[model samples]
Target: MLKTLLVQNYALIDTLEIDFHQGLNIITGETGAGKSIILGALGLILGNRAEATVLKEKSKPCVVEGTFNLAGYSLQDFFVDNDIEYADLTTIRRHINPAGKSRAFVNELPVTLSILKDLVSQIIDIHSQHQNLLLADGKFQLSVLDSFTDNLQQLASYRDSYQKYRSLTSELENIKEKASQAKADLDYLQFQLKQLNEAKLKSGEEIELESLQQQLSHAEEIKSNLQSAFTLLNADESSILIWLKEAVSSLSKISHFFNPAEELQARIESCRVELKDIAHEVEMQNERVLLDPAELEAVTQRLDMILSLQQKHRVSSVDELIEIREKLDVQVNEITNYDQVVSQKEAELEKITKLALKQAQEISDTRKAGSKKFEDSIKALLTQLGMPYADFKVNFEPLGELRPQGIDRVTFLFSANKQMPLNDLSKIASGGELSRLMLSLKSLMVKTKGLPTIILDEIDTGVSGEVADKVGNIISSMAKSMQVINITHLPQIACKGSHHFLVYKDQEKETTETRIRLLTSQERITEIAKMLSGEKISEAAITNAKHLLGSELN
Candidate 1:
């Protein structure tokens, strides 16, 4: 329930503070007396849009704050979810700067407008005359039936299944699309993989092939050099090895007579042996260096193939080409296995679809059963609200496909006369009838759903006399369960409230402001008299106001 509203520097409200009470709190004033301004201020705290134009002083910010008593409401989870401090008396405040910047706060903690709206919606409902159009809305009608049936848990389950079904169906479609696209590229991938496999690639093959090609290309020059070296060392008559052996023999003859001669003979022998080994290696190399065009062509072809593969794959080495081959192999394998993957996804989708269908059927059946009870209850309430011949029904139509709400489309039908056939509420119900119907629906909702607070803004606009009294009685009855605030011009409704408040303009030297005050019993009588007669209060009007107040009290 709302406890207090404070407005500062708001439109036509320089500074105002009002305390609200439980039960039907009636607010009354003449037209243009700033009654709606209070509601507007309340709307701001409820997370409605704010503008710089709403600021009374262009240099000052506008502030609207509301205090709510949340002792019995189970909203601790909401506070924890939003990371806000919760108290038994929670205050929500809104501030709009001169630059049109708006900010919201919950318990002095900064919050987003969405969070503010969500928290406020759970605690208060502001129903204006414009909201009567919701009576004809199909979603709203279905919600009414659901509320009456207490099928929120079931609806939640159905929605969960529906979401799963949708996700799996979407996954199946994507897999099928992937398979279709992959099929187009399957043959090309296979050909590439087969080419790579037949190449028989190896690491470092290019470097080895290049070295072999160089050796084969210069075979004649290498053979000529090796033979020349062998001839100089061993095959010639005055070879260096022959001279070194003769020096070794000479040194060996004197080596027994002199120590230096022995060392010299050893050095000369080592040189002769090394030269003989060099000549042998040269001779072998000369024999093996014969020019062979077949071997040259084979090495050249291998090098050319390595270069061609590197260029074809846009890589710098055989290693990169090998990596591309591995990737292509995986792609081919996946294509081969796509059919099984798609079949598995399709099976999963079919299972979820069946489950969703069953849950939707259960939900539809519950709605069908609740709809009859809802229609009967609303018709009875409408009759009590001065629509004695009113007829109400819930019309269900089959949907072409499943939806989140289910497979049924609901419409509310109404007829205000006995002989009239039921038609859509929008086409048949007048403004007054719509108002009464909205009240009837709200009254029924109170019995089913535990509403926190409801504020009716001039719902009694087109109603008066005994019907107005009945409207007052209905609102008064609703207040028994929760807080109900009715802003009205009818004395009958005004007298029905447990507490009365009057909104009027207070003009000072240079500024005019709107103010509200709780009316005492005598003050209430005087206000009701003014509403009964308007502008001029007569003795009979006062008597009638007292009698009406007395009757409502009884």
Candidate 2:
């Protein structure tokens, strides 16, 4: 519950502090006494947009600090989740600086306004007089019903499963798409493989065949040239070797007479032996040479075949063709296996989808059952709140597709009179009916959600006397389990408050300021008297106010 609110230079409030208490705390004041200003400042702390005009002294900043006491409420988890420190009492502070900067803190730890709002929302609900759009929301109606029936755990589990299932299904689809594309590529690869394999090719065979073909094509000419060169060197008549042998014989006989002639004869014999050896080697090489036209043609044909295969495959070497064929074979094999894998995955996805649908249907069915009981509970409360002829129902429709909230759409149906048929609650419900319905639903939510504070802004907008007393009584009952702050003008509701604060304006140094003071029992009686009689506080109004206070105390 909200413990203390301190405002400085916020609108008409200049340095005002008000402490709150548990149970129904009512704020009563004159129409323009700045009662709503306090709520507005509180709203700023709740993440509402801050108006820059609230700055103080026309130059200084505005500050609004609120301290909330968590006590035994379940706000500890909220603090833990938000990384906020919390003692037995938690303080939430908000400040608006002169430079149009707004700052907030939770338990003195600086935080954004969104974090403060979320934390505050978990503990308190501020209901203004405007009709609640949440009431018209189909999903919200279903949620309220589920919360009323204690189906939170089941609903949460179901949603978690649904999300997981959706993720897995999406993964399966992506994998299948890639696998299908791979298969198409694989088919193209298989065709290339077949074309490459049909050509019987080998590496380096082209170069070997080309050399053989050139040799065989010129074999006759080469052999004729070798024979002619051999004849000129040794086989011809009057060859140089024959003449040198005779000269060497004559020179050897006269060597004793001349030493230079003896040395020349020896060199001449050495040259004769070398020349004979050379002739024999040449003859052997010439004998080995052979030429055949048929062999040349065969070699040429083999070379042409190898080069043609190379051009057809666009490979510079036969080795590359072999490599390409191997790669294509692997691709074709993968394509053959792809269909089986996809079939397996599809079957598995279908099974998981079925399980997900079953779970969602179960949640939808549970919500419908809860909705009936929820409607009955509210209808009973509405009767006590002076809506005896009202009929309310929770209508459930089964939607086909899956949503984050599940498969059913819920709507609230209502009829305010006995003969009227039920219509959409938002279209047919009046402000009073909406207020009472909101109160009843809030009362039911307290036991489920465990919030400790609920503030109603002008809930009794069109109510008075006995009806206002009933609204007071409902809020008073809620205060037993949680603190309720009612902003009201009705004396009946004001008298029912366990704690009362009166907001009024006063002038200090010719400047108007709003002040809030906690009222004592005697002071409350006087305030209630003013509320009962408006501008005139007659003796009868005082007696009536006293009696009303007395009745409320009893």
Candidate 3:
């Protein structure tokens, strides 16, 4: 429960401190006496937006702090999860600087606004007239139904399965898309592979073919040159070798007459031997260099095929073509195996879908099982609030496919009169009906939600007389289990609080400021009388206020 609230430098409130107790706490003030301002300050602690405009003192920051007693709320896990120290008495504070920057703290440890909002929501619910509009929202309707069912664990399990199912479905879609694209390219891949294999290519075959083509193209010229060289050397008797042999014989005849001639003869003999070997090699080459058109054509055709393949494939060498062939082979193999992969993914998707559907069904069943009791309870409460013929129903529509909230779509159907057919809440319910319905639902929720505090700001907007009295009684009944702070202008409701507070403007100050004070017995009587007679406490109003307070005490 909220133990104390301290607000400073907020709109129209310089510094205000107040304490709240465990039962019904009533706050009554004139219109524009800053009751909403107090709630707005509390909103900052609840992580609502803040601005520099809210600062009454331009230089000082606006501060709103609430101390909560959290001993029996089972909120240790929340503190542990947010990594903050958990004390039985915990303080939550919000500071809004003059520049519009805001910061929040839990138990003096700095925290993000999201963390503060989450923790505060678990402890308190600030229900204003605005929340009555939420009755028509589908998600809110389903959430209310689920809260009544008390199926948090089942809901958590369903969410987990639903997330996995969505993920697997997405993965399966991607795999199918990949397989489709690969199959589209399969024919082209096979054609390229076939052409490469039929080429019978080798790593160095193109170089060898080019060299052979050069020799074959020049065969006739090579043969003619070799024949001429053979004739000059030793092909005829006047050749160099024959002339050298004659010189050697003359030198041998004069060897006994001159030693120089013998040396000259030996040198001419060596020249003759070298010329003979040269002539023999030239004859053999000339014979081997015969022009064959068939062989040349074959070599030329092979070289042309190699060059054509290189240009068609956009490669410079056979080695590059070889690499491409290997890569295509791997792609073809993977394409062949894609069907098996897709089948595996489909099976996995089916498995997860079954699990998700099962969990969703369990959730749906639980909701349906408890929905009758929920409707009966709401109808009973509505009767007490002066709608004796009110009809309420939880209408469930099963969805065709999965959603984040599961397969059930819940809508609250209502009829305020016997002849009025059940219709959606938004179309048929009046403001008074919405107020009473919201209060009834909240009364039901506090029992299951176990919140420590609930602040209702003018929930009696469209109610008065006996209905207002019943609303106060219901609120008082809610306070038996939790703390309820009601801000109202109705004297019937104001007289029912265990403690009463009066909010009024202090005109003594230079600037008008809103202030609150806990009313004593005489003050309560006077305040209730003032509320009854409006700024003039008449004798009849005073007697009536006393009787009302006396009856409440009974």
Model 1, residue 351: C-alpha shift (Å): 2.1
**Tens digit of lDDT per residue, candidate 1, span 101-122?**
9999999999999999899878
lDDT of 3 by residue, 328-367 (tens): 8999888888999889988988998998999898889999
Best by lDDT: 3
Model 3 ranges with Cα > 4 A deviation: 57-59, 186-338, 507-512, 551-554
lDDT of each: 0.89, 0.81, 0.91
Estimate the lDDT of model 2: 0.81
Better of 2 and 3 by lDDT: 3
TM per candidate comes to: 0.83, 0.67, 0.74
CA RMSD for every model? 4.5, 9.1, 7.6
In TM-score terms, candidate 1 sits at 0.83
Q: Better model by TM-score, 1 or 2? A: 1
Better of 1 and 3 by TM-score: 1
